[model samples]
Target chain A: MAETVKLLFSATRETVYMVAVSVLIASIFGIPLGVLLYSTDRGRILENSPLNKALGTIVNIFRSIPFVILLIMLIPFTRWLVGKSIGTTAAIVPLSVAAIPFMGRLTETALREVDRGVIEAAQAMGASPFQVITKVLIPEALPSIAAGITITAINLVGYSAMAGVIGGGGLGDLAVRYGYQRFMLDIMLYTVAILVVMVQLIQVLGDLVVKYLSKHR
Target chain B: MIRIRNLTKVYTSASGTVKALDGINLDIEKGDIFGIIGLSGAGKSTLLRCINLLEKPTSGSIEIDGVEMTGLSPKELKEMRKKIGMIFQHFNLLSSRTVWGNVAFPLEIAGFDRKTINEKVENLLNLVGLSDKARSFPSQLSGGQKQRVGIARALACDPKVLLCDEATSALDPETTLSILKLLKDINEKLGITMVVVTHEMNVIKQICNKVAVIEKSRVVEQGTTFEIFSRPKTQTARNFLKSMFICEIPEELKAKIKALNGNLAEGRVVKIGFFGEITAKPILSEVVKKFGVNANILYGNIDNIQGTPFGTLVVQFEGKNGTADRALSYLQDIGLDVEVVEIG
Candidate 1:
């Protein structure tokens, strides 16, 4: 029982690190890509139809691929980039790649929900496209975008656990190594409890942050 | 001054072709409050959008202040758009911006210095009677207040022409009156030509000196407000006037008037419309004394159109058969429009 508890603690830390790092990378690339998708449509102030469609198609294609298959397929590339594809650090490459498309789609949806009239008002005022996007669109969409980020963060937590199946050092790996292989039901139970706790903590924090950021609140 | 020649816009949707504006030709003289009245789908809004090239016309030319807008490049179009202000029915102020920020937007886009922008924004907010709402967001404002901000922002560049696309349609009656008065004041004070598009005759009556009635993507009637109201030429103009003024005359009221008056052969009921200085003259008394016809007043309405009094009187004439005809001739001779109505 004591050994089970120790394994659960280490696995919980690994899962937290992987989820946090991957979400950070996803946000960096995904938000800008999403903004680009929004501004580059036909009739938009900075319209470039081909570019917008191409980026949108690429994001969609990546999002449609199963995350488990993506992790396996990215193993060779992950090894080349990180010099290893087994640990939590190497696992981050696939995790963040999977998250980018997911986060981008969420960000795009959030941004699209912003009122077009607001953008027009900005343009009618003689604001450049950049100013409209930054000062008007982004600010108006911030609350929805923040909620989207929370959704992405929670999704990444689930993806990170799946990453453990490929020998990635997280709670799922700990469950397989010390619980499944050895038939230690107590270890599996403890690992499951810790993961539940982690997920619940993230969800509560996300809900609170989203509520705080919302105008109605 | 704004001039549009053969301005056309065609939208080819999946279903087929829709001609939003078909060869619209208009010349708005300087300092005239021109009103374009039309029903929904009448292309009035489309005409206003074409002025600023918001909805780029498929063909034709738009010249504002003698500069052909259609010929300008994109950069030039943007620059020219700064000098042609437009407001919308929805009061499309940026929700993310405060009242002050919304007013300052155009100035910032014009690349004014921070201090000058601040001073101008303050003055504009004060002008709109929203001086205390500088820091308040659009969500915090009422419909009237939001539209006032729209007005202030549109005036930010101090354009020579202001295009209003049903600018007061969203406000209550009292607020609409105040906004109309404000626009009239602005027109007089700044001498800015305003092109107001609305379906409401009241709006046209309140501020427009010149008006054009559009129907089915075409200008069916165009002239001074007095000319259109006093003598509507087209069927479209007559229909609009009937709906605007006589909508309150219920079917029961018409039936009662018919029952009380009997058949048309007994007497002649004429509708007389008077405008300007002619309204003050006791024309009814003069007609009775001059033509020896007994004139019984039935229904009457007098309204001020752009500070000029326009009056309409429905009266029944009783006496000799030829006396009614002579009375009508005398009324017309005295410069009052007299249209004889057939009683059923």
Candidate 2:
């Protein structure tokens, strides 16, 4: 029982680390990618159809790939990146790669929801394209973008669990090794309970932030 | 001051090509509340946008204060745009920003320091009468209040010219008047040139010193507000001022006219327009007495336009010996516009 407690504690820490670091990395790359996708589309500030289409196709290909297959497919790149093919740290690569496109698509949608008139108002005031994005577009879309980030974070939590399939250590790895392989139903139930609690906490916290950021109320 | 010479804008879509503006020419003096009045789809908005190069004109030249707009580089255009502020029909205030932040947005774009931005925003908010609502978001304001915020934001850069794109179309009648009053006050206090584009004739009537009537992507008429109101040359201008003219012959009057069967010996219906000192002089009565014609007044109303009293009267002239024709000619001779409505 003591050993089980220690394993659960370590597993929870690994899952938190995987999800947090992966989300952080995904956001850094994904936000600019999203802004590029939005601004390069036809009729936008930085309109360039060819670049927008190319970026769109790349994001779509990544987004359409199944997470399980993506994990295996990214093994070589992951090994090259982190000097290891399997572990919580290495799993972040595949998780972040999959989430980047997802996050980008969502962030684009959030930005697209901003009013066109507001954007024109900014332009009329002599705002450069970069200034428009940073000052007007992003700030106006902040609440929706925050909501998108929340959804992306929740998706990362799920993806982090799947990272366990490749010897990536987390609660899912603990559950599979002890509950599935050793037939310990009680341990599996404990991991499921913890996952549900983690997801709930994330959702509640995200809603609070969204509510606070939303000035439309 | 703005001078637009043969400015044209052509729009092409997958469906076909459209000429949004064709050979528009205008000369607006400084401190003038110039109005572009047109019906929907007449391209007045496109013309207003052309001033700031928001929609680049397809051909011709636009010069503001002697600087050619069409030839300006992107950076120079941006600098030029900073001196020209615009307000939208939708009152496009940033939803996420407080009134203070919204007003400060233009100052921020102009790269003013934080202290200057604060002081400028405060002065602008006071100018627009939104000082108490500085901390409130746009969603918390009414349509009129939102437009006040829009005005405040537009004035933040101390722009020399202000463009109003149907700025009061979204507000109620009372609110529209209030906003117009504010615009007039701003124009008076700051001596800023203003270009207003609107379909509402009342908008032109209320504040415009100079008005250009646009029809079918072309400038049909351009003159002082009183000139256009007192003597509308084009059919479009006449149609727009129809409500102001009260030329609708009463049903009873129409029946009375129909009873005469186009007999020259009986009477004729004439619509006479009087402007400025003409309204004060009893010219219609004098014409009747001089021509030996009996005049029956059908409809008449005096309107004060730009401090000038302009009135229109529809009357039935009963006389023998071709005196009605002489009376009509005499009215036309004395600078009165006379149109034969019905010959009875």
Candidate 3:
């Protein structure tokens, strides 16, 4: 029982580390990508349809790939990136790669929800395109974007569990090794309970932030 | 302080080219509350947008304060736009910002320091009577208050010209009046030139000193509000002005006209339109006493246009021996527009 507790603790730490680092990295790249995607859309501020389509296709291709296959498929790239093919640190490469497009698409949708009239009002006030994005579009879309980030982070939690399949240590690795392989039902149940708690915490925290940011409240 | 010469905007889409504005020329002197009035799809909005170069013209020249607008670079245009403020019909206040933040948005874009932004926003909120609502979000305000925020934001840069694109079209009648009053007050207080675009004649009647009537993408007529109201020159202008009065033959009057159709020997119905000092004169009484005719007023509407009384009256003149005809002729001779209404 004591050994199981220790394993669960380490597994949770690994999972948290993977999800947090990947979400941060994903956001850094994903936000600008999302803005570019929205700006290049038809009739938008930048308005380059071809560029929008190209970027959309790339994001779609990455998003459509199953996370399981994406993890295995990115093994070589992951090996090259973090100098290892299987570990908690190396799993971040595949997790972040898969999550970047997910975050980008979500961010783009959040941006699209911003009122065009508000954007025009900004432009009429002599706001440059950058100002329109930073001042008007981003701030107006903040609540929605924050909600999207929460969703992406929660999704990363799930993806990080899957990353534990091939020696990428996390709760999923412990559940597979101790519960499925060794048939320790108690160990599996405890890990499953912890995962559920993590998900619920993320959702509750996200809802709180969204409620606070929403002005209609 | 704005001159638009042959300003045309052509929009080409999948279908074909649409001439939103064609050969539009306008001269708005400084401090003038110029109105561009037209029906829906008449290109009044396109003309207003052209002033700020929001809608690029197909072929034309716009000069504001003697600087050619169409020739400016993007950076220069941005700088020039600082002097021109615009308020939209929807009261496009940023939903994410408080009233103070929304008003400060323009100042921030103009790169004012934090202290200056705060002071300007304070003065602007006071100017628009929204100082108490500074911390409130736009969603918390009524339509009039939202527009007041829009007005304050537009004035934050101390713009030389203010463009109103149906600024009050979204408000209730009482609210519209208050917004118009505020706009007029701003105009007088700041001496800022204003260009107002709207389809509602009442909007033009209430505030516009000069008006340009656009029809089918062309400037059908342009003149002082008094001129357009008192003496509409074009057929389009006449038709547009006709909508202002309740001149349609009422149901009861229609029955009376039908009854007295062919049997009208020494009686006739005449629709008389008079304006300015003419409305002050009791011309109908003069005609009654002079021509010995009994003038029965069936329908009438007297309106005040820019301190001038403009009225339309439909009267049935009845008498024997052509006195009724002489009465109408006399009303015409006295500078009243008298049109003989056919009883059919």
Candidate 4:
């Protein structure tokens, strides 16, 4: 049991690293992608239907591929990116790729929820495209965006468990090897229980941040 | 001066093309409180939007101070819009921003330094009489207060032309009057050229120096309020002018007149509209004094709009003889809009 606890501690660290890195990287690419999706809509700020469609297709393609299949398919690309395909960093490649499109679509939905009248008012005030995005779109959608980010982070936590298929060191690997293959039900239960706690903590923390950001509150 | 010539806007959609404005031409002089009045979907809003290039014109040109806006590039157009401020029926104040923040947004976009932005926002807040609510979010304010914030936000950059789209339609009657008064004050003090779009007759009558009536994407009539009130040439203008004021006869008085007249068709209830210098001319007493034709003044509405006195009276002539004709002709000769109504 002491050895099992030791292995669980290291697996937990690996799990946190993979999810945290994936979400951070996803945010870097996904935020701009989401803004592009919303702004390029016909009659919107950028107002280019062709650009919107092309980006939308790319997002859809990434989003539709099953996470398990995506992890297997990205192995060679992951090897080239991280110089290895069977470690925590290698797991980040597939995890972030899966996360990017998911987070981007959420961001698009959040931006779309902003009042169109507010946007027009900004334009009437002579706000340029960049000013409208930074000052109006993002700020107005902040609470919704926060909630979306929380959801995306929680989803990344679940997706990271799939990284264990490629010998990635995380809670999923411990659960599959020690608990499933070695028939230790206690280990599997412990990992699943910890994952649930992580999800709950993220959700509560997110709700608080969103509530605080809300001006109407 | 702002001049628009032959402007047209067509919305081509999957359904069909909607000609929002068809050849709308207007000239708003500096400091003129111009009104574009029409029913919903009559294209008054479209006309106002076209002025600032919020909706790009499919044809025609808009010239502000002799600079052609239609051909201006996007950057130039944006710079031009800095001189044109717009408010809306919904107020459109950002929910995420405080009243001060919302007001500061325009100035910030113009790249005003922090101190200048602070001073300008303070002055605008004072101008709109919302200094006490600077820290309040838009959702926490009343409708009138929210509108005041919207006005302040629009004025933050000290725009030369202010466009109001049904700015008072969302308020109560008392609130509407106060906001209208505020707008009039802003116009007079700042000398800002205001272009207002509204369907409320009182809104037009109370504030507008000049009005253009739009019908089916075309301006059917455009003139001073006094001219439109006194002589409406088009059927659409006449329809709008007829019921504009508080002209409803009290039910008790209508019944009393009907009882006294004894005959429904023969009762002489004339709805007389008088405007300009003629409202104070005492035309009714003149008819009574000259023809001795007992003119009973029953009900009327007298109002002073933009320093012009406009009146509508429901008068009962004692006798249904040709005296009514003479009186009407005399009234017409004196520049009064007179109509004979059959009262039963």
Q: Which candidate is the best by TM-score?
A: 3
> Against the true structure, candidate 2 has what lDDT?
0.90
| Model 2: per-residue Cα lDDT over B1-344, one tens digit each | 89999999999999999999999999999999999999999999999999998898999999999999999998998899999999999998888889899999999999999999999999999999889999999999999999999999998898999999999998999999999999999999999999999999889999999999999999999999999998789999988888556856667867766675365465678888788997889887798789999888877888888889988888888888788888889999989879888533
CAPRI band of model 1?
A: acceptable
Better by TM-score, candidate 4 or 2: 4
* Residues A159-191, model 2: lDDT tens digits: 887888777888888888898999999889999
Worst lDDT run of 10 residues, candidate 2 chain B, spans B258-267
RMSD score of candidate 3 (Å)? 1.8
- TM-scores vs. true structure, each candidate: 0.93, 0.93, 0.96, 0.94
User: What is the C-alpha DockQ of each candidate?
Assistant: 0.48, 0.72, 0.68, 0.78
Worst 10-residue lDDT window, candidate 3 chain B: B240-249
Best by DockQ: 4
Point out the worst 10-residue segment of candidate 1 chain B by lDDT.
Answer: B244-253
Looking at candidate 3 chain A, the ten consecutive residues that score lowest on lDDT are A159-168
How do the residues B129-188 of candidate 1 rate in per-residue lDDT, one tens digit apiece?
A: 999989888888888999999999999988888999999999999999999999999999
Query: What is candidate 1's CA lDDT for residue A90?
Result: 86
i-RMSD values for every candidate model:
2.6, 1.1, 1.4, 1.1
**Overall lDDT per candidate, in order of appearance:** 0.84, 0.90, 0.89, 0.88
Task: Report model 4's TM-score to 2 decimal places.
Answer: 0.94
- Going through the candidates in the order shown, the clash numbers are 0, 0, 0, 1
Q: Point out where model 2 deviates above 4 Å.
A: A1-4, B250-253, B256-265, B284-295, B317-333
